[model samples]
Every structure is written in structure tokens, then in C-alpha cells.
Target: MKKHIILSAILLLAAALLYCSGDRQQVGQVTLEWWQFWTDPAIKPTIEKIAADYEAANPNVKINLTDLTWADGHEKIVIAFSSGTAPDIIELGSDWVAEFSSAGQLADITEDVIKDTANFLGWSAGIWKDRIYARPWILGTRILFINRDLLRKAGLGENYVPINWDQLKEVCYKIDSLGKDIYGFGSNAAEKHRLYKKFLPFFWAADGRIVSLDGKYSVFASDKAYRALKFYKELSDSCSMVDTQRRLEDAFLEGKIGVIISGDWLLKRIKNENIQLDFVTTLIPGPKYPGKSFAGGEYLAVSAGSANKTEAARFMEFITNKDNQLLFCKANYSTNPSSKAATTDTFFTSDVNLQTFVKQMNMSEMVPATPQWVYVEDIIERMLEDVLFNDAPVAESLYEANHKIKELIFKE
Candidate 1:
């Protein structure tokens, strides 16, 4: 009751604030508080420049920007929304749209804006049950990074990359010169949420998805689920790779591993470290299916308690527009959700390697898009890791997971 009261007070306060802004045309003044996730230094200036441009066009409106980490942003937004002190605009993840929208803490953007304002991978990323709540920022799919230098010494070709599990296994088998100081693969498979992020593709490419479209159940206990876990085990055993996510990144960064699965974020580090590695990024592999991957991107939404909801949406629409998306992504070193931008831009289109990621995004599957997903995916990941590393029987582990998922869907 106290929480609801607080949220209500906030709503009233914001109503009054927006009311005040309405009369500001007399003085020609409006100011919006905006929040964004942390950016690469190169990208930060570009974003700030976007704000400057907007300010120039609308001299009466001022945007006050705040930077946040993903983890930090959640706590901050929750408190702000509860107290009616939330900013006018904020950045969010795709998975978060439903959670925030249902809380009555996000603006219902359906009638006011044309969602096609920006070209993105899939409009569905920010739309839930036919209502759009957020705008996408950056998008890119995961890929395999190989150290071509390591392959040659293992009697593999000077330039080699794996397209499937069998090929990856062959490379790992030949390249696991443990005593001679080499490992085949590595990943931060131990980071709880991240482990799932890294592994979702394996589950997806084998013709599996995390949740039913109705958002009611998990398929982790299904046969396809069994195959997904089984393949991870096989891949881990044969590749001589460690199960931890950072360990895998560290191994690849050190140039000790022949292959590692990573995203575009690693590009700068690979180039700067002078690792003598000719790495290529490609879709992850599968046996029963061609290797598909997961698509991850960020989105922006306005707080329901925000006083500047209308003005905030204007900024969201403007920033995500095709031309701005190009400027933002090119500076950010990541992909944007803008599908048209992605299809036509010389940056991604001209490069086969970069295009591979966009292709994988099309074939990708999303994680369960529920607040319960955090808990559900956590429970599912640990069970799969236990089976993969300890050789736990696939059927029993999957059974336990599927039953729990159903229980959770109701529980949530």
C-alpha cells in the first residue's frame, strides 16, 4: 500500500509538472532529464553531439543527460519511479520493456508515435502484445573468434575457422597442446546470467527456443533441450576449453586459445593488444541444425512518472531515426536495431564478416522475456552446466528444469 501511495504521489507530481511545462511557451522554455547507459569514449561524444543538435533545433527545450551502467540503472529507475522523481527519458533492455510497462512505469507509445521512425532488426524487440514502449540503440549477434596463428602450429591451415560442432571439435582436438601451452576454446561460462547469454544460441540453433510464445512454459525439458545440453558437453569435452566466461575471454585475449565465442565489444581489445591473432567472427555451430545465434540490443523508454513524456518521446524518435542511428552506431562500434540502416549502410553491408552477425541476428532467438526470466534462466543454466561438466544424465536434469519452469510461470 505504501509503495502504491508513493507511486501515485509521483504520478500526481508529474502531472502537475507537465502542466507547468505546458504554460512554458510563454517564456519559450522546456527542459527534459534524459538517462543513458555507459558508452565507449568515442561514442559518448557522438551522443552528446546529438543532444546538442536537438537543443539547437528546439531552443526552448533542454536535455540534461545522465550516464548509467545497466546494473545501476535498474535500481535507480525503480526508486525514481516509486518516488515520482524519475527522469523524463531512460535507456532499457528489450527484456525489460514488459516488466516496466506492466508496472505502469512506462509510457504507452502506441498512438503518438510511428514505430517505423527507425529501421531496426525487429520491431518486436520493444513491442509486447502490440504496444511499443521503447526504441532500440545498439544490436549485434554473438560469433566465434579464432586465432589463425595458433591453428598453423597445430598442423591446421594458417587460416581456419569452424562452421559446425564437428569442425570445432576437430580443431580443438588438434590444437589442445596443453603442456605445450595451448587450449582450443574458452568462454566466461561461469558468469550466471552471462553463461545463459553465451549458451542461448546453442539451444536456439538446434531448433529450440527459451519460452513458448504465450510466455507460459520453458522447453528446457524437451528433446531439443536434451540435444542442446548434450552438445555443450560434447563441445566442452573435446575443445579443452574452460567453462567460465571471463576465463574464455582471458584465454582468447592471451592468444592461448585457438577459438573463442565473443561479440563486437572485443574488437577494440583484440586490435590493441597486438595478440598476433587473425581472428574472424562467424555464427556458432550446431549438429541437428545450422548454427543460429541470439540477438541482443538496448532500447530507450520514458518513465510513466516522467513530467516530460511527450518531449522525451520526441527525443527517442529523433535519435533512433535512420540517419542518427548510422552516426551513433558507426561511432559506437556496434550495430543498431534499425533494419533499414543495417541493410543499406556501407559499414555493415560491405563487410562480409560484419554482415554475418546481422544474418545471425535474423536467425536468433530471444531469452524468455519475463521478469521471471532472470530466475528461470538461472536455474536452467546451472543444471545444464552440471550435466555438461559432470556428465549428469540429460533426461533427468531437463525434466527437473521443465517442471520448475512450469511451476515458475504460475508462480510469477
Candidate 2:
């Protein structure tokens, strides 16, 4: 009996040693932190699947995805970076490419990976100072959205969606003549930063480019910009619902407006409801040039100080790939395709209007990738409201806008 007890004790000790050794080896696996602004119900599941599949393939690594809204995403990411808790992989707006990259908060990815940017639209929007920093997972560009149902009622449904801004205005006049209370065209002219989102599309149609390629200063006071602003004010005079982009989006979902310039979210909203709404998208056209729109997209980046950079980057690559992007887009019904092959998915390729956005991706010009651009945009937004709502003359107002922007940007 004594010999048996001693043998049992020895076996138990050996078992404990083996368990401890195995645990230590497993501890070396990495955990990567990824952040994004995808709180929409349709989007969360797709992102989760991507993360799960990636984790399954990389058993040695773990991905932690943090999702938020656009406003919330910007605020929280700024806070996290400030608090030194930035994630390994961060997905942000192109508008923020300069803000975060300039602060030395992002990893320099120019030479770190092989990229086929030519195959992707808006892929080059996030570059700053000739260095690649973040990569886009999804994108949105401004496009013309017309309601065929309303156009038909106005006796203009015969391929009613126009090819140029002037034709669009003519169509609006026809609709306006139909009723006093109803509007033929409506755009979100009152939203804060959103004004630029709407205005840039029209401005570009006038052969106007908002940002200088050098990323130096605001060109909003240029002749093209003045024409864009003046034209916007004129459009609003006949349109009802001078609401924010959010409201314009909501209004579009309810089929309350005739036409709008909006993002992919509007497409998803209409499709999800199975509304028998007939709609189409077209390029903004100008006299001497084709209409242009702002091209912007969502990007995923790794934090320079993250403990899981490698794992996070790998997850980003997997998520942004064709298979995962297609799955997510098909399930959600609203995402802009990121990968070249993903655009061929029957769900997207079958829709003519949807493809217009994908095509516009090529003609898009990214917003200025300068650290001071946010403040500059703010100045532009406020001045636009003044020009539209107030009696401020265009030239004086723009000069003041330029001066005010210079003050805010240069104010230490």
C-alpha cells in the first residue's frame, strides 16, 4: 500500500508539470486589436464573419474588432490614441488619413506590403507625403439618385434621369411646375460637414476641384467654387426639406424626394424594403468637362504602438479580400465593393445604378490629406450656410471664409 501511494503522487506531479509547460507555449499567440465604424445592423454580422474566418485560419492569433458610428468612431479613436490605447488595426475615413498619420499614430505601410492599387477605386486616397498609410475596406462617392416614380408623374419618366447638372435643373423645373408644395429636387444643404459632401459633387461638375493636389490650402474661393456655391443656393430655392444629410437620407428612404446626391447607404435602404421604387444614377456633367464628385473610402490601419500589428494587418488583408467583401456586401445589400473581383458579384453587377458608383470611384478626387483640413472644412461649411441662408454676397463671403480658415488653421 505504501509503494502504491508514492507511485500515484509521482504520476500526479508529472501530469501537473506537463500541463504548465503546454500553457506557457500557448501564451505566445498574438492578439491583434482592430477598430472600425460599422454599427449598422446590416454591417455587424458581415464583419463578425470575416473576423471569425480569419481567426480560424490563424489559430495562433486573435482579432478584436471594435465598431462605432462615424461621429463616434472619430471621437473614440482620437480619444484612444490620446490615451495610448490605440488598436493594432484601425479603420477610418479618408478625411482622417491626414489627421492621424500626421501625428505619428499610424504605421508606415509603403514598403511593408505588396499592393495592387490600380485594381481598386479610391485606394490611393489615403496617401500623405508620398507614403501609403491605410488601406480602404469600403468606399462611398457622391452620385445622382433619381426617383422614376415621381419623374413619371411629372411627365418626364422617359429615361428621365439627366446626364448633366443643367438637364437635372430642367427636370427639376418640370417637377416644380407640377405642384407648389412638392419639390422636384432636394439636397442636404444645411448639414455641417455634410455641405461639403453635397457641394463637392456639384462643384466638381463645374470643373472645380476642392483640394489642391499638394495638400496645401483651401481652393473654395476659386471661381469654380463660387459658381458651385451660387448654383447650390439657387437649387435650394425650388427645393423643400433643407435638412441635413441624415434627414435627406431618411427622406430618400421614405421616397419623399425626387432626386438627391447621396451615398451607398441610400441604395441599401431602398433595396432592403423591397420598395417598387424605380431609380437610376448618373454622372454629374458640365459644359467643358464631365461632372466630378468627391471620392472617399474607409481604410484599415495598424497602430504603431499596437502589440498585435502583424495579426491585425493579416486580418485586414483577409477582410478586404474579394471573397469576404462579396459575402459582406451580398448580406448587407449596401456596401461598395473594395476588391476588383468582388464587383463582379451578381448582386452588385446586376444593378445598373449601383455600378455607376463603382465606376465613379475612378474619377474621384480625395479630400485634402492635411492635418488642418478638418478645421478648414468646418470653416467652409459655416460660410456656405451663411451664403445660402444669409444675404452674404458670394465673393465677400468666400474671402471672409478664406481668411477665417487661415486663422483657425494657423492658430497654433
Candidate 3:
């Protein structure tokens, strides 16, 4: 009996040693920290699958993904950078790339990745001071969302989508005349940062710019800018501006709003909520040209302080390549592929509704790539609110905003 007990003890010790050795192998492997905010219940699994595939292909390297919430993700990123614990690969919002790259926190990948970026609609957002610091991963755009039922009730045909700003106003007024609490258009008011994107298309179509080419001056007080602002104010007056985008969308979903300019996320929400409403999206009505949309997207950037930059870049390239991008965008219905091949894939071309946003990509433009963009955008939002809500003159409000932004741009 004593001999048998000693043998059993030796066997247990050997098994424990073997298990620990395997654990140590995994622990010793190079693991890159990936911080991302695609935490939707449905989309999270797709990301996990991608990570698993990447790990299967490269056994020597592992990815440690930390899911983030949109509400506090930016704050958390700033904290991580301040504490010297930033992740190796970070997924940044379209507006955040310039802010981070300008701070010298992002690795320059101009020569190594996507050298010919003219094909990507939102590529300019990832560049800071003429240096490419991030790769465009997912692209999307806003279109004019129309309520077909409301149009029919207003004695308009289902195919009566506006082709220009003048037609939009005429249609809006016709719908507003329907009475019974129905509104012509739903425009956002007083929402910080959001107000800029909502109105930027108009300014861009009018050939107005938010900043100088060198990004060192504010050009918001130009004649074209004033024209755009005046037009927006007049449109809002006709539509009856709502205090928030959410309210605007809700009104649209309820069939109380005849028209609204909204992002593809609204389409996803409409489908998920199963709202019994007939709606369609089209290119936003333009002034000087056809309608234009905001080219919004997400970007992947390697941290300047990351020890595993090569691995991070490899993973980014793998995921954003044409095939993978097409797969990912297919899963996320509202997302448009950033790659040229993915953009032309049958997945997009086959669906007429999807093609609307895909076609708008040709007429889309990204916001100014400036480190001070956040500050500049805040001033413009206030200017918009002053004219749209406070009844301030468009020219005067724009002049004040231009002056404030000039101070921010030229400040030492």
C-alpha cells in the first residue's frame, strides 16, 4: 500500500508540471493589446471570429482585445495615453484620428500601408500635417431619409425624392401642409459637435471651407459659408428644428417627419426595432451640384509606443483587406467597405438600397483634418445654434465663429 501511494503522488506531480509548462508557453507569447468599441451584441462575435482566424494563421502572436463602450471610450483612451498604457492597436473614430495623430501618439504608416489612398473616401481623416498615421477600416455616409407613406399622404408620388435644395424645400412645404401635427422636415438644433456634420455638406457643396488649406486659418466667414448658413436657417424654419438627432429620428420613424438627413445607423435601428414604416434613403439634396454626404469612417492605428507595432500593422492589414472588409461590412448591414474591391463587390451592387449609400460615397467629403478641429467644430455648432435658435443673423454669427476659430488656429 505504501508503494502504490508514492507512485500516485509522483503521477499527480508530473501532470501538474505539464499543465504549468503549457500555460507558461502561452504566457511567454507576444500578445498585442487591441482596443476597440464595436461592442454591439450581434457584432462582437464577428470581431472575435476575426481574432480567432488571425490567431490560427499566426500561432506565434496573440491578440488581447479589450471591448470599449462608445460613451466613455474616448475618455478611457485619453486616460490610457496619459498613464503610458495605451494599446498597441487602437480603433479611432473618424473625427479622432487627427486629434491623436497630431499629438504624436500614432505611428506613421504612410509608406507601409495603402500608399494610393485616393480611392478611399474617408482616407483624409487619418492624415495629420500631411503624414498618414492610420488606415481607413470602415466607411459610411449620411443620406436623405424619406417617409414614403407621408409623401403619398401629401399628394406626392413615392418616387418624388428631391434632387436639389430647392426641390427639397418645395416637397417639405407640401408635406407640412398635410396638417394633423405632421412636420415638413426634421433638422437638429443645439447638439454639440453633431450640428457641424449635419450642416457641413451644405457648406461643402457651396464651395465653402471650414479652414485654410494649411489648416492654420478659419475660413468660415466666406460668402459661400454665409449662403450655406442662411439656407440652413431657412430650411430649419420650414422644418421646425428638433433639439436632438434622436428626437429627429424618432419623429421620422413615427411618420410625423416628412424628411430627415440621417446616417445608415438609423436604417439599422429601424430594422431592428421593426417599426412598421415605409422609408428610403437617397443622396442629400445639393445646392451647386448633386447632393453630397459626410464621409465618416473608423480607422486603425498602431501606437507609437507599442512594442508590437509590426504585429499590430499585420493584423490591421489582414482585417481591412478586400475580402475581410467585404465580409465584415456584410455582417454590419449599414457599413460600407473602405477597400476599392470591397466597394464594388456584388454584395453591395446587388442590393438597390445598399447601392444608394455606396453611390453617395462618390460625392462624400470628410471633415477638415486639424488638431484644433474639435475646438473649431464646437464654435461652429454654437454659431449654428445662434442662427437657428436664437434668431441671430447668419452673417453676424458666422463672423463671430470665424473670429473665435481664427484665435484658436493662430494661437501660440
Candidate 4:
């Protein structure tokens, strides 16, 4: 009887100790919900590996990732915020940060991020009301992709590349004259959110401003904007086939299109598919010189409603560090790391084609940072469609767009 009691007591003590150990282990463990937009099969693994590595380093932290698509991600995020079920961290397009930050949906992270502005580019995309709400991650820019064979067949040497507005127009016309069902330019059609990006570069290259620096009014009705629109219409009507960006890229790949302005995603597709085509990328030709291209990027932001703000911020800082960002950028071939040090890696410095992108990115400009930009983008797209497709007068279209934008910005 004494032995039985002693054995039972020992087993009870052991069970109690194990239960306490398990309880203690759960005390400091954290699970974070992370929503991101990189859904490519080739790139998703790298993203998972990044999160896994972060978890391995910080054993008490866990990340649960949810993949989002560009098509529906914005709508889903808005719904999540409204339902009070937002994630701990979100990977937002650079254009979206301002909208969320200004609406109080994003956590203000100015003090949590690095103070060195030179270390990362595109900081303005993440700032709203002078407060930083996101960290720039992957940066990319659009450049002109030329079909070398088309240029040569058009009686221009392979070495011939457009350097200015007149040269570009002349080259495009020459290519169009080939008359074998080939197009000189791949112009974007009425893509609601996209046509504005294609059009704004021309506007900016012609020295157009959409709004004043104070964000108080629209300056989009200037002669520069009208001139830009007139030129765009001429180019589109003369030698271009208008289509969605995807169809345009497919046409470019099929050798039916001569020149197209596209970002690194196209580059990645070409390299990945091992397509055999002679082509080169160049900066967008300007009215007088090489013009500024549109700069776009991915950014990381903590959700204002996250329960684990500190842990979320730490994870963001970790993943955006030089080494991790370089890894991510390497896996995503056409993208540059936001980290300045990562760009110094031989991977970027050694490639001549990538150097073209680097040069263009240096001269690129982002759209204005404003919560009203979504409405403004829609208005501009409508204005372009009016002139480019509906035959609306360019000057009148600009006046209407400028008026609508002014109402959106200055309205009470």
C-alpha cells in the first residue's frame, strides 16, 4: 500500500510539471496574419522561405500568410477593414499606401522605421500627412522594349533606338509602313486603373503637373497636358493597336508589335520562357531628351487594427533588410530591392539589361500622393478614352478632367 501511494504521488507530480511547462511555452508565443500579393508560383516559394526564416530566427513568433491577387486584393482589403478582421501586416502597392494611410487604416510607422532616407527610394509613396505609414520594398519602372527585327526590317539599323519624341514617332511610322499586319506601338486600351499610368509618363515628360505641391488644386489643364494628350492621340491613331496590357504583351511576344512600354514582369516572362527574340530596352524618349518613366513598387505596412503591432513591425523591418530584400529581388528578376545597398550587389551591377532599368528608375517619377488619387485616376482614364477612342477634342477633355479633379480635391 505504501509503495502504491508513493508511485501515484510521483506520477501526479510529473504530470503537473509537464502541464506547467506547456502552459509557460504558450505565454510568449505570437501568431501574426500576413496578407501579401505575390502569387506567382516561382516567387511564392521565396516569400514563404522569407517568412520561415524570420520565424526560425525569432522562435516565439509565427506568421500565417494569405495570398491576394491584384484583381481583387484592394476590394478584399477594404472589406476586411470594414469587418474588423484585418491582418497584422499587408503588402500594398505603392499607389495604395496613401489611400489607406490617409483613411486611418494603416499604422503610422515613421518612428519604427529606419531614419536614413537615402537607404530606401520611393519614400514619398508611403507618406500621408507627413507621416510614414509603410516601408517601400520592391521597386520597378516601365521602359521601352523594342523589337530589333522590326527596326531592321523597317530600314533602320539594329543599333537605331529612339532618343527623342520626333525620332520615336518617325521610327514608329517607319515600322508601321511595313504593312504585313504589324503594329508600330502597343498602346493600352480602356484599362480602368492602368491607362492612367501609361498616360501620366507622357504628361510628366511634357512637364505637366496634376496638382500643386500643397495638394490644394488641379494644374492638369495646362498647355503641357493638352500637348501631351494631342501627341498621344496622334501616336495612337496613326500606328498603334489598342488592347489590354496582357494582350499587348502577347502581341509583342508574337512579333506583331514593334515597341511597347512595359515593366520587369515582361522581362521575367521572356527569360523564364526562354523565348528566342532579339530585343532591347531603352528609356522612354522625351520631347527633348530621355524622359522620366513611371516608378511603381511594393510596400509593407502594419495594420492599424493589428493586435501584434510590435511583432508585425519587427517582421517588416527584418524582411526589408538588405540581405532579405536582395534575395527577394533576385527571385523576382525584374524588380530592384528598395535597399540601396542591395542594388550594389553584382547581380544588379553586372547585367547590362538590368542597368538600363536602373538608369530609367533613377529618372522615374511616382504619381502624386493623395487619398483622392483613386478618383483622380479614374477621371484621367475617362478623359483619355474620350480623346483616344471617342474623338473628344483633346483640349476640351483636359479641361473637363481638370475641373472634375479640382472638385474632388477642393470639395468640402
Pick the TM-score winner.
Answer: 4
The count of backbone overlaps in candidate 1 is: 16
Q: What lDDT tens digits, residue by residue, belong to model 2 across residues 72-113?
A: 778898999999998888888888888888899998776644
lDDT against true structure, model 3: 0.83
Q: Given candidate 3, what's the lDDT at residue 142?
A: 81
- Tens-place lDDT per residue, model 3, 221-311, is 9999988888888878865547689998988888889988887788778768887888877888788449677787889999999988888
The model with the greatest lDDT is 4
Tell me the TM-score of each prediction against the true structure.
0.86, 0.87, 0.90, 0.91
Indicate whether candidate 1 or candidate 4 has the larger lDDT.
4
Query: Considering lDDT, where higher is better, how would the candidates rank from best to worst?
Result: 4, 3, 2, 1
Report the C-alpha lDDT of model 4 over 162-270, residue by residue, as the tens digit: 9888999988899988997799998999998788888878888999999987877799999999888888888899999799999999988988889999988898889
| Candidate 3 runs further than 4 Å off | 1-29, 116-119
Q: Which ten residues in a row have the lowest lDDT in candidate 1?
A: 334-343
Stretches of candidate 2 exceeding 4 Å from the true structure: 1-28, 239-241, 246-256, 407-412
Instruction: At residue 384, give the lDDT of candidate 3.
Output: 84
Q: Which candidate do you rate higher for TM-score, 1 or 4?
A: 4
